[model samples]
Target chain A: MIKKMKIWQLPLMVICLVGFQLYSDVVLAHGERAQQAGIRMRTMYWWDVDVQPTTVKVGDIVTITGKFMPSSFWPEHLASSEVASFMNIGVPGPAFLRMHSYVNGTPMVRSTRFFRGKEYHFKVILKARQTGVPCASCCQC
Target chain B: MGYTDSVKDSDNQSHEDTSRSDVSQDSAISTPEQQRRIFRAFDWMLVPVASILLGGIVVFLVALTVGDWDYWQDWRDRRWWPLVTPVSLMVAPAVFTYFFWKYFRLPIAATSIMMGYMIAAWVSRYANFHLFADFPMAFVSPSNFIGMAIILDSVILLTRSFYLQGFIGAFLFGVVIYPLNWPAAAAFHTPLVWDGYIVTAADLMGFMYIRTAMPEYVRIIEESTLRTFGEAVTPLTAFFAGFLTILNYYLWVWIGSKLAVSRWATKLI
Candidate 1:
């Protein structure tokens, strides 16, 4: 019977809703088609990529080293001109934890005035939290 | 009504017509005291169903505003975000007001929507872990609308009018939200000097972290030349937000009242 629902039941219902959310946890993200045509490709030329120990169990650390040289082209609407920028490690999700990263022999903890045309050497260390295939996202926007 | 009409018209030749008429009329013309009791039962029914529907709506709206659009993060950085975000946000609350007015009335409607929105936000953040896998929970954190929701409900409770609720509630919500969020948002704004550049903790984190969904979001923080003026533009933006909220409130109130087609209090049951 769809009779009157009790006032007290509402509070209890909210409690249940929250309880459902608290128990299980995971994350899904976007990838691949993130950038515009020939934008990031034209701007950043990445080469000499190296990754060791591709397969690992929970909580295993892996090292990655790469270098990229920037081109002169920057997006018009997004670019604020010679502003502070940082070298970011692009990963899939909480499947792996980012421990630390270094760019050009400096800990990339802060933003720097990254010139338009410059070469950057980068190294990153990540710990695997969940056992799964290694997936990464490309950001050009 | 059915009993009275049947006894009076069709039972004219029946022997028991008089007794049937008396009983039917008595119930049809119910005493004021009995009517009061029936209405009171109807009121009790407000709680459960209101919560479920409102809560569902809240989750959808929260995902659109805080998670998908990343409005909060945008506010910290963009010059136009503070002004436009409220205008954008007003859309959900305004559309929601129609449901609030139609079925639930004042207190129950306002309270349900408010509480539901908060709960939904938290739940959406949680769902990423279990259902929407591969997206970091950090990218879509739980939003806090407790302040605005409370203020909105308080206005309707006190004034019992959508007019004042819109005029007062929207204004207060617009003015206070930025400050209420500041306690948590402050951590993001923490200043750091890196290689002769003054950047916030938030900007750096955004640059460092990788969320494939959000590659290059537009961010024009304090570095803009607009700060050259003596006073900051934040307050003006808040006021603009308030104005837009009011407009949205009026529209939603009109909508809620219109959808409130059923006058019978116990219709939902």
Candidate 2:
């Protein structure tokens, strides 16, 4: 094949090869980057995701922990802002599963309670979703 | 041979050969001046086109995710906040200026600023309809606020002054932003029906974030009512928004100018 190729086609061949390599690198990088930043899923209020492997394959469990404290505010305020004394635990928008979030060893569920300054903990199991880089600032998987 | 005969004339033939060789030599030697000229030309022309296109892209994405253009046929009642379209679109100009200043080191003045907003709005509108709404650009109409942003920007750019940029840019911003948003947003601008009592659209949009509740019903105003509010709200909206946007634009543009004059931050490395 090398002997059969035209001289003029050599640059084109090199360009095509380089393009494919760059694309694969981008795809691989995003997943690896996401795993490293997966700790972002832990909320400042409830849980803090501590340890995660540098690379995680599908069906692998990632531990997520949350420390809960005694309720210091009215329950009404906890449920709805209009009546509540507690800051909602669901403040940083919605939660993501293994990729975005794993709360107390489970996925994030919808609820409005802030164990005001209390200590409660949970673990998250990592589950594979789509392929891409997770934003450490916002979403991580 | 006639053409060749002229070239072969004795003294002239030598001169022609000399020039031809010069041309070949020159082709091998690329001048730095020529490269600079090419870069400068690209700076003036290509940069602006890219900037405008960037502006359009921002608007397009917002239109997609915010408007939920996919299910337009239903036009079911949705709370205004679900739309979360920024209360004003003036942020576009300021944001565009910031990006241009940060990345391109180019001063975005007057019409260019407005152009940014207009492009952003157009793109967002296109994106909203096509991506989310599942409609084409033609079917998804844009607001005259686009025209207003461009016009305001044009006037400021032409004047090349700050006060006019701030006052006029913001005024137009305040005036047109919401109105431009109203047509598509009207569907979602229903009054709050919280706890089973009907409340004004203003209440839900301003203070509450009822993320989970199902949309109840759309409020259908009669033709007369629509016309009445259209006449009344349009000018009022513009005036109020224009004031704020103008103040904001002034601050951002000044910041942009300052950034332009200041030296870039240096690192020890």
Candidate 3:
């Protein structure tokens, strides 16, 4: 005979599994997405994310434009202005595929910072890094 | 709870009546002691699993904080950016907690809770520095934090009182915070005069070339030292840092001992 799980145990296990997966997803998102759980240090301008052709296919030329606004009390732990402004575009993962980033129009292969209220916009080719997901950070948001 | 109950109510009146009565009687009976014992047993049994899960979470948090998000998709990323620190620092101390609690009749619930902070800090670093913004520290270098955690755990392992552990661990925590982080942190702050321009390694790597804002012409280094170790200042700093680490170690051992002795600990099988 199959050992039956108690009525409470079944729900508890499901909760644990979902909790574990959510924890994994946050850890995978890295920076702003990861840290917001504790100290919500940065306030983002999601309303300002301008995406040309919000829908795109693999290998489509899409432009993603957005601005990140840090709070007035940006931590001094952040040493440099260049190190404070950062931008990243990627799908949720198994694999975090970063498509493009820029620091005041300069190509940012590494993470960089922007001024507290400054805006950043970028245009790039979205070569569907992976299949089955629609290409838009906002759509997912 | 089952479809059979519905069928029995419709087709088997006698069986349905008996089953309903059994359910009502079982619900009415008091079994709090049995439930408590069962939960206590489960909690003790799950300790190792919980410890492993805590360790894994720490690894995941470290990777997010330390590893470059741009390189997460890149195949050539290092195998152990985040995991190494947690495995050594966290797991060792957790295992120490488990052993202390089980073998030496100590309770380490507090130490386990502190691991949550370590995980949170790791995740926050990843979110704030490594992922969201650009700070020029390589491989997230959270390994520096392992000593702090080890010290915290060691205090719990060595002490018999929470008051003493809390007082000493907190002090040692503050004392060793700068030292443990100094080496890697120093790399980011090290002043380098590159091509007549005063810059850090972060500035050397294609960071901003802000010549106009700071006016590079005005800044000048009158004295220069290229020796592997900078004058006596380097040695003095190292000696002080090492001294702090040893002091933290002593404090953590005490904390670990205190945690291991709580009356709330479940019996080990």
Q: Compare the candidates by lDDT and give the number of the best one.
A: 1
Question: Candidate 2: which stretches are off by over 4 Å?
Answer: A1-75, A78-141, B1-45, B56-88, B95-144, B178-234, B265-269
Q: What's model 2's interface RMSD, roughly to a tenth of an angstrom?
A: 16.1
lDDT of 1 by residue, A21-73 (tens): 99754331232432656666655668998997887888788989999776577
Docking class of 2: incorrect
DockQ of each: 0.16, 0.02, 0.03
- Taking all chains together, each candidate's TM-score versus the true structure is 0.62, 0.38, 0.33
Which candidate wins on TM-score? 1
| The 10-residue segment with the lowest total lDDT in model 3 chain A | A25-34
Tens-place lDDT digits, model 2, residues B235-266: 55456556666676766666665655435544
lDDT score at residue A122, model 1, on the 0-100 scale: 86
lDDT of 1 by residue, B1-269 (tens): 33345434534633456776567466753344454565566656866666666677756664565344443242353345455555555555655555654444544454566576666666756685434554444544544566776787788778877788889987877766667666766666666654444556554444434444342333224332112111366677778878877887788677666655765556775
Off by over 4 Å in 1: A1-41, A56-60, A72-86, A110-117, A133-141, B1-46, B68-89, B95-108, B129-141, B181-210, B213-237, B254-269
DockQ of prediction 3 = 0.03
lDDT of 2: 0.43
The number of the candidate with the highest DockQ is 1
Displacement of the residue B28 alpha carbon in candidate 1, Å: 14
List candidate 3 stretches off by more than 4 Å.
Answer: A1-61, A65-83, A90-96, A103-105, A111-121, A133-141, B1-248, B262-269
Q: How does model 1 score on DockQ?
A: 0.16
Error of 3 at B59 (Å): 6.9
